[model samples]
Target: MTWKRLVAIAIVIAVGFVGTILAGGLLPSGLASAQQEHREHGAPSSAPAAGAPTIAAVAVDFKFTPPEIRIKAGQTVNLVLTNRGAILHDLIIPGLKFHAAAEPGKKGTASLTAAKPGTYEFYCSVPGHREAGMKGRLIVTR
Candidate 1:
């Protein structure tokens, strides 16, 4: 083969390889790795125990359903986050330093223990998600 043809073929192969990696092919099960990374980053890894106080939140098209959550101080809460949109979503409580992510059409759970009686803000930490109205308020009672 000609040198120019060989170089062209090599370039095509390189591009395809890079594309595969960018598309998460290099990761061991994209979803699994993502969840593992979430846990490693201090995010809750499991759902609240059965019958525990659970708050279900649906994320769809840049909004969180039932945008306000109420809880009593010192209560443990299982935050059930479902991404109903065709994109990734997550619920993050900056005040409590907690976060969890869910892929499209999937669900994830995180546990939170309400601390002091106060109002805290929760939002999607994804870039531009919060600004797009992916936020809510958490009210804790004494």
Candidate 2:
């Protein structure tokens, strides 16, 4: 594309994005409401599934409190991430496809079933957070 045409396209895209935000169309209605509720009340009050172990985890400004967690293979793990810092934090276990995000002073939850025994790294995907030491290790034991 020509330079001028590219610039015009960029401007149009930016304008559309801004308009969407201003019109409160950034997220769908159900998601927005759920997000609001999550921010206000943390995770749901429902009980954990049978035979699943609930592991409490906390995230701070630059690190996860435990820094590491240990669980068993062939077991389902329920991780609860609580953000006590002044910013958002999230837990992501790559291979497990498990992710839980918590806003400041709020909480989130996710479940992962580790089928093998090994070490898996968990980190916050937030920009610069992992580099700042916001990460931990999940040690799955057989």
Candidate 3:
């Protein structure tokens, strides 16, 4: 390539690298504080205690009471599922590989001991539930 073209390409690559770093550095302090809050709340990005259990929240209808769940490895998961819907519903955590069915005017729960850390998908396995857009993620750290 021509000397000028080569110099321009190099500058572009340099600028891109710097831009990424700057953007990352410029991320809001809220994000950092949020991470700190997680740490303070005992949410580590690694294996959970051997007997410690994770808490998962399930949604009802158009709302996810607590849209996200985070947990350490080797911990038991207590999936607290509430049905805010007027009809029966279900919440399935694919990563933890479990499901809980909820009936109207009642609460439901599914429990599991998570030995591994990874991302999980949750969906209403109840017939036609997922088709109504009842689904979310269950993340396990590591």
Candidate 4:
């Protein structure tokens, strides 16, 4: 029946909208805020601050390319991650509280400004990935 099909479509739309709303509400404010600046610049850009250095990183089956990142204290770093793996992957710098994630075959970006010179551990936050060797270090120099 045409009416029955319309009702089903309406329900599906409503459920999808509610799910989107709930998912948005559940994310941390910082993550949600950064995600809001999405633009179609041929690709997503995190728009790092002036003079910031942009670094390209890759994520494979269970490892991160390069395995290390270096930056200068007081300088902002923009990182772009491309997921070349067959599963979801993410980048999380616990100390700096920076996170960037890309689903399989997708790309993601994040920016971090380290005001202190030190070594910070960065890794993929996805469950079990870190233990499988998805960890690295972010060295900040003065």
- Which portions of model 1 show Cα errors greater than 4 Å? 1-42, 45-47
Ranking by TM-score: 1, 4, 2, 3
Instruction: Report the alpha-carbon TM-score of model 4 versus the true structure.
Output: 0.65
Model 4's alpha-carbon lDDT is 0.79
Candidate 2 backbone clash number: 0
Residue 56 in candidate 2 has what lDDT? 92
How far is 84's C-alpha from truth in model 2 (Å)? 0.2
Q: Which residue pairs does candidate 2 place in steric collision?
A: none
**How well does each candidate superpose onto the true structure, as a TM-score?**
0.67, 0.64, 0.55, 0.65
Cα displacement (angstroms), candidate 2, residue 51, comes to: 5.4
lDDT of 3 by residue, 83-139 (tens): 777876666555554656667767665566567787776666555456566667667
Candidate 3 displacement at residue 3 in angstroms: 79
Q: What does candidate 2 score on TM?
A: 0.64
Question: Comparing 2 and 3 by TM-score, which wins?
Answer: 2
Give the worst 10-residue stretch by lDDT in candidate 4.
Answer: 36-45
Please tell me which predicted candidate would have the highest TM-score against the true structure: 1
Q: Candidate 4 has which clashing residue pairs, if any?
A: none
Off by over 4 Å in 3: 1-58
Model 3 lDDT at residue 113: 58
> For candidate 1, lDDT tens digit of each residue in 1-142?
9999999999999999899988876565755655654445455545566667888999998899989989999888788999998988888887887787888999998888877999999888665677789899999998
